[model samples]
Target: MSEPVTLRVLGTSVTLLESIRQRAEEELGIRLVYEIHNVQQAQRIAVMQPERYDLYDQWFHNVDFVWPAGAIQPIDIRRIALWDEINDLPKRGRLHTSDKLGAGSLPSERLFVQHDGKLGSQPTERISMLPLTHNADSFAYRPERLPDTLAATEESWSWLINEGWCGHIALQSDAAIGALDAALALQAAGLARFENLGNLRLDEIDQLADLLIKKQHHGHFAAFWSDDQEAGRLMLDPAVSIQSLWSPTLMQLHRAGIQYRLAVPKEGYRAWFGGLSLSRRAEGRVKDAAYAYLNWWLSGWPGAVMARQGFYISNPPRARDYLSAAEWDYWYDGKPAREELPGSDGLPLIDSGERREGGSYAQRMGHISVWNSVMDEHNYLVRRWNDFLRARKAA
Candidate 1:
């Protein structure tokens, strides 16, 4: 008897679940190994050693870095068993024509493998990655921690940088995503403006750094976190009043009994779509297993699991079948939960009568102010951002 093929996957913990690994190994007859790292470390590995992973599970914005490095092979659209069922958002860039293409790398923008050997939005047989889970994200806060004056006003991104919240606030630490979060807060507070929030220029990057440094001097932040666990721990600190957050972290907070409100910011939420890409080094049997894993993600079960955790999967309707009518109604349809709903961990997290803060998947997805992005001036932004990270609080 032949040994099962061992397929190595590299990504952040966001989607690298032990359950998924177990099921894939059991169902696909392959030994699936996951190298889970923080987003920054995972990207470094993806670029520094593309041969190390058979499949890369990451966000579309990563194409900005990974594609140019020739780390991943374009997936053949024809080979995707349910390609036709995939929604228009990733393919055409919006769910509806009127839907705004939020600033950054839309799945469509870098999806296709053009004739010139570059990725583009044009329809093509080859795609950079297989679109999988996505979500619209915003900051979470304790309503009791908010002052009455601020509580009365509609929620806004400016709250992150609001002087009133200084010394009680936090931010995501990743330059690619956190910089955009900071930019939105800065723009909302009238502190700075930009031509494209998704693609910051060098001067604009410095402008943000200058302002952020001043804020640091004033002790504006309680923390800056780089991963989900850190973000959740920061949220637990009474000193951390408000911070940009991902859905899973929010859900974990709820489970911990904090009931932190995920703000529907007036400026809209930051959005991101994550997917799987075949490694350039994968070939023959290993490559087949890689494609199998990609296809397996969209096969309804995993999408249903992500859906439970507040992510919308590409081809949601397919995943919908795997969920109960009430689950679909609450998670995707934006209706109140008719009964207590278990989170991805199979524990009850969303209580009965709870409605998703941003309403239905369509409503939430429609309000993206920006997508998680790797800006044109990303490297310079990182250098300055790191400097800010290392800076001391003002006396």
Candidate 2:
């Protein structure tokens, strides 16, 4: 007579939750119905219709404006065993009072890290969301197009802006401001100085204006993508050559038998993370079930599954316990085009570490950047970018 316990989670696909639900039911003896909602819809439900969703899965960042608006609960996970497996426990704790674990098994997600230095060793209190999984940003290039004896090294960031490749590559239309951000980092670190921060400044119109001018004079951009799929299409063409890319997008291309390399440019890797959080109203069995699900996901198996697929895990050591040597080599050093990327049977291997029987991967990296007072300038950045794009188009 009563409705089945509906665990409405905002974010992720229905298929993902179905897997979790099946596991929870079989492993934890809990029968639950699951529903998936989009991030935008989840935000509105969290604020306007609190009763709608029992959970929310999404990303937390300096530029994303949803969390501060009271759209989700900050979880408390200090007592949870899985929290110990996460490298960035303090930072994740700070974001969501209720989010305490990663979602699914994946290798690329080892541990979480944040180099704020301001927090010292204190446990984070103003929680918003827990990291479900994370990924890094890297360059995707066709080896055939690059000159022999390429000089880009992974230790520095300057190799990306070489004048020779200026117009030939495709840059993200939405992420154009990131180029300027990288340039600013160069100035901040006293590595290399670039004048006219105006060019680097995040003014949308200004960025558009600059790009338009460049397009007229250079005819360099092979193509521009509004989303990752479009970018992947360009990469598969081979004729399009190189582009700034996120590893997940590259993974999809790799699965399709595409040949591309993760550039070890002079600059270090660029990346971001996302996580899961509970609704403020969730309690009792639902909460307990969620916690159980969270713990199983982070303890190694799921973490390794995600990592070997391209996205680097936040907890590497834990994932290593689950992933095999071959899987590890394939992810860390092996190229998908050069070898067959193992799959989870017929599935796309959405989470690769799942293939590992008892793998565990841990985290790496010392610092993470989240939305904070100093990094809260994305509004200005976005506005400036719009201006840059508009101006560039006119030019």
Candidate 3:
């Protein structure tokens, strides 16, 4: 028997990993091992040490950090079975719009490889990463606790920093994601404005950091979470009334019979795209196994499992085959679930007739206010973020 192919993937991918593990082994004859890490650790590992992992399944934001480090090799599109069926987000250059960052700053701008060993937007046989799961994120609040006065007003990201929610709010612990969340909240609250929210300037970083520190000093945050379990735990805390949230955690909370409303803020949702990449070290039979894994990821089964957890697959048409009509209508069409919907664990999480908070897939993705990103001043941003974390009151 051959050695198992080891994959370093994000912790959020647990369900997908479990869902596909047995089948992938049966179909490809390659045993798979997954090393799960938080977003920060996953980014660091993928960029600093390729030898430890054969494949990386993570957010595209990490491309800024990993690609230049030469830790990951470009994927050959010809190898991907559904390459043409992939979403137009990359080919149409929609990722580099003016409202978004410039070409150099856009992660998808250099998705294709050039002859100079550099990435470019031009069509090429090689791609930086095989785009996979994506989704829009927003904060959630306990509607019953929401003050009537504020409920009448427009829901906003500024609520994170609102004095009224002091000691009752939570935030993501990741610097990259937390910074974007804070930047949006700061702009909405009129505390500061960013020229390019994805890539913050030094002054913008400082301003946002200072505000976060001040909020911490006042005990504004009830908790800071790094994973779905942590997010779910924080949400269940009576002290927490609102916080940054992801779709999977929302489903988890619902399963536990906790009622929370995912906010459709006036400012819009924080969107993100991510996928699988082969490590620079992968070659020979291991490389073949890696490609097999990537193809299997887009082969419909994994995509359908991800859909149950609120993620959109890159090859939607392929994924459709594995999903039931009720699942498709509830998850993609934004229609109410006609029957009880099972979670990744096959246990019912959503009851019939419950509408998704942001509505349909198109409606949610179309309203993206910002994408998850690694700023040019990432070093300085990390320093400031660490400072805020150090100054925060212990929960």
Identify the candidate with maximal lDDT: 1
Of the two candidates 1 and 2, the one with more favorable TM-score, higher being better, is 1
Model 3, 120-217: lDDT tens digits are: 77788998888888888889998888866586788899988888788998889888788788889999999998898878899988999998898888
lDDT of 2 by residue, 1-395 (tens): 54334455665441234545575567655565555554335445665654566666545442134444444455666645766566644343322344323221111221221144121223554344555566535456766666444544332333344444555566565532244434433443454443343223334334434544454354545555555566777777755667776544655765787766665433233435656666666777667666666566666766665664454444556777876665665554332323344542224442333222111122222222211111234456556545434433222
Off by over 4 Å in 3: 1-16, 93-107, 393-395
TM-score of candidate 2 relative to the true fold: 0.65
Query: Which residue segments of model 2 deviate by more than 4 Å?
Result: 1-4, 12-52, 62-64, 88-121, 124-126, 147-163, 173-227, 281-289, 314-318, 329-341, 344-374, 389-395
Residue 83 in candidate 2, Cα distance off native in Å = 1.8
After superposing all C-alphas onto the true structure, candidate 1 shows an RMSD in angstroms of 0.9
Model 1, range 44-154, lDDT digits (tens) per residue?
Answer: 999879989999999999988889999888899888999999998898888988988888777889989999999899999999989999999999998888966696789
Better candidate by TM-score, 1 or 3: 1
**Whole-model lDDT per candidate:** 0.90, 0.48, 0.80
Error of 3 at 47 (Å): 1.7
